[model samples]
Target: MTCSEKMGSFYSGITCQDIPPHVMKKARLTLFDFLCVLRLGAKYTVINPIIKRYLVSLEHPEKYTVLGLKMKSSLEHAVLGMSVVSHGVELDDGHLSSATHPAVAVIPAALAMAEKCHSNLRDLLVSIVVGYDCMIRFAKAINPKHLSLGFHSTSTCGTLGAACAAGWLLGLDSEQLSHALGIAALQSAGLQEMLHENASIKPFQVGKSSSAGIIAAELAALGSKSPSKVFEGQYGWFNAMSNNDYRETDLWDRLGKHWMIMDTYVKLYPSCRYAHAAIDSALELYDEGYRMSNVKNVKLYLFQQGINEVGVFKVPSQYEDALFSVAYSIAIAFQYGKVRIEEIASNLQNTRILEFADNIDIISDKQMTDSFPREAGSRIIFEDDNGNIVVRENKRARADFDTPLTDEEYLLKAAQILENVVHRKYIDVLWEKVVLSDQKMDVKEIIELMNEMGA
Candidate 1:
């Protein structure tokens, strides 16, 4: 069978029994991380407004609870709302190979479909796992070139992942699932131009991709038919968008044996993943008592890929710019002792921060540049007023799956977000159930608990 056929067959054949205990544990952690990030986005000015606007436009409200918001929206609207919130802070889980935010795309779609279909807890979790797996696998299949070719992977690959998850939730077999993917592929579109212009449309890509995936799955359920070979056919996704030689076998090489959800990196900082290593290096220096005032010059060495990704902002004047700006992130870390979600909102143009950012120089270090994608590393050199120099290097940040945050640390992060949206007592109670529940609880129950807390 062709790659697309094999993938379709694999998705159709896989069952909960196929998932190992360790993989399921990782999936649960991912779900927790997703909820935490979504809550954090609830407090973001940009995210709340978009969610409010979308919620206000819902034609017929459903029973699904929009996270953090006390309102109910249509399934489509709910998916859109949740997606915006998930991506609002840009802190969602990301697949390094595809460079797509899988949770942002998959979780929203899964939640919306679960509410509408009245799926149980097991169903909800499986759908999320399936969605993340499909999205990341497709993204890995179309690697660096798809992202480099000016298509936003989060939107493009996310759409396909959303479709797969939605299809699974709706119980579509291989044939119908294939059609859903094809339909979603046609609707999948997000330009990297938003990055070039530094616009707010970047986060919207997640919502759009997720909503489109739901639409595709619904169409397929209604007996729609589309091309099955959406990935590796002669004029398929890879060839059309990537403009590179296509390999169909890469799509299903180790399908069930390797779970992509485990490969995702959870963000410690709320900024871009490309900037994490630089932030790590800066934070290390600070923890070692490196003061900002004493530093005369700050130099950063990163991989060529890092330079291409986070090195865009020469002089960022705004919060969004700062998120994408390695120079700005490094400077903020040096000046403020750390970078937080709040730091992105605080005026970035503060003279001290700007002055430090201006003194920041970023260059591609050949040694680090050669090992990129395999490893994200950075080196920071600080020169003191007395001409003393301190250098710190970090190969990767702590939030990666390889070096995951402790349970307490993860819950603390979650609590910080939950405290902002709901009451502190609710955070403690809900966290108790979430962390220690023997049997999985329904997602709706979780939402209901939050609603009660708000009430």
Candidate 2:
């Protein structure tokens, strides 16, 4: 069987009962995080303008609900608008091995379809899990190399993965699911060039991928036919985009045995995953009695993949670019002992962050290449003013840990996001729908809940 066949078979055979309890728990946790982020994302100073443009330009009647907004939008526009904001804030969940943000793209696409089809939350959970599995596996299989080839795996693989989830929710048969995958595969495109400097196109990649998934699935349901060899055929995703050979079967073999949804991690900082290890290590150094003043110079030894993505834009010339900078993240984390959204905004070009960030050098480490994509390891060498040197390594990145967030942590994240914009009632409704419930949810009601207090 080809990749799509194997995937379609799994989608057809898998049921909510077949998902393990732990995987279900992670799925819910992932959803909770996505909801919290979107609540804050819709109001971002940068993204809100883009939202208004679409709202004004399209101005269509309500078909699906856009989170944190009163106006309803058509399904594709709704998915596109919500996904752009969801990931625009840069606090969304990601699978480290494949380096894809599955939840941001997959969840929005799934929710839009659910609202349109009147599907329940139980089925929504199934679709999300299946999407994560397909996306992360494909990403992990080809990336680092896929990234070196200049393709953003998140958007490229994301289109296909979200299609799986969307197709499943729309009740596409095995053949139709494969057809949807083929349609999405052809639409896949996202470049790392957006990471260069303050480009607003970053979140649009996820938005387009999510919207493409729904559109592809809809087209497939309307009798679209495509090749089963879409993933590995001549001039297929692997042959055309990958810089190295990718074998998808082994990753697929571990699918049911290992849930990729569980492997995906949440970010404590709203920066690129490439810079996460350095942030974690810098925070630890501060805790170990090493202040920014105590440090003379800092050097980061990252894998080639990390260096390629984040090293070029070392010191962010603009606010949004800070999310993709190693120096900026390390400097901010070391300066304030934490990285926050407000700091990135208010202190985008703060002299302190710039001074520290300028002294930091990011060098590509060839030796560490083997541990990348799968492990996301990094080494930090610190030189203090007193001539005392500290070398620290973050091997088991904080983002990919096995434990889920506690109840307090979950609520705190939500409250932090909902701090200045919405009322307590907004959070109350959000918490109930995302954290406290497990029954079949009418997705439209979920949208209504967001607008309870006129969000």
* Residue pairs of candidate 1 with colliding backbone atoms: none
What lDDT would each prediction earn against the true structure? 0.76, 0.79
Q: Which ten residues in a row have the lowest lDDT in candidate 2?
A: 243-252
Q: After superposition, how far is residue 205 of candidate 1 from its true place, in Å?
A: 0.7
Score candidate 2 by lDDT.
0.79
Where in model 1 is the C-alpha error above 4 Å?
A: 45-47, 61-63, 246-249, 416-423, 452-455
**How many pairs of residues collide in each model?**
0, 0
Candidate 2 deviant stretches above 4 angstroms: 68-70, 421-429, 453-455
**Candidate 2: tens digits of C-alpha lDDT, residues 280-329:** 99889888878778887788999888887767767787767777778888
TM-score of each: 0.93, 0.93
lDDT value, residue 414 of candidate 2: 71
The all-Cα superposition gives candidate 2 an RMSD in Å to the true structure of 2.2
Mind sharing the TM-score for model 1?
0.93
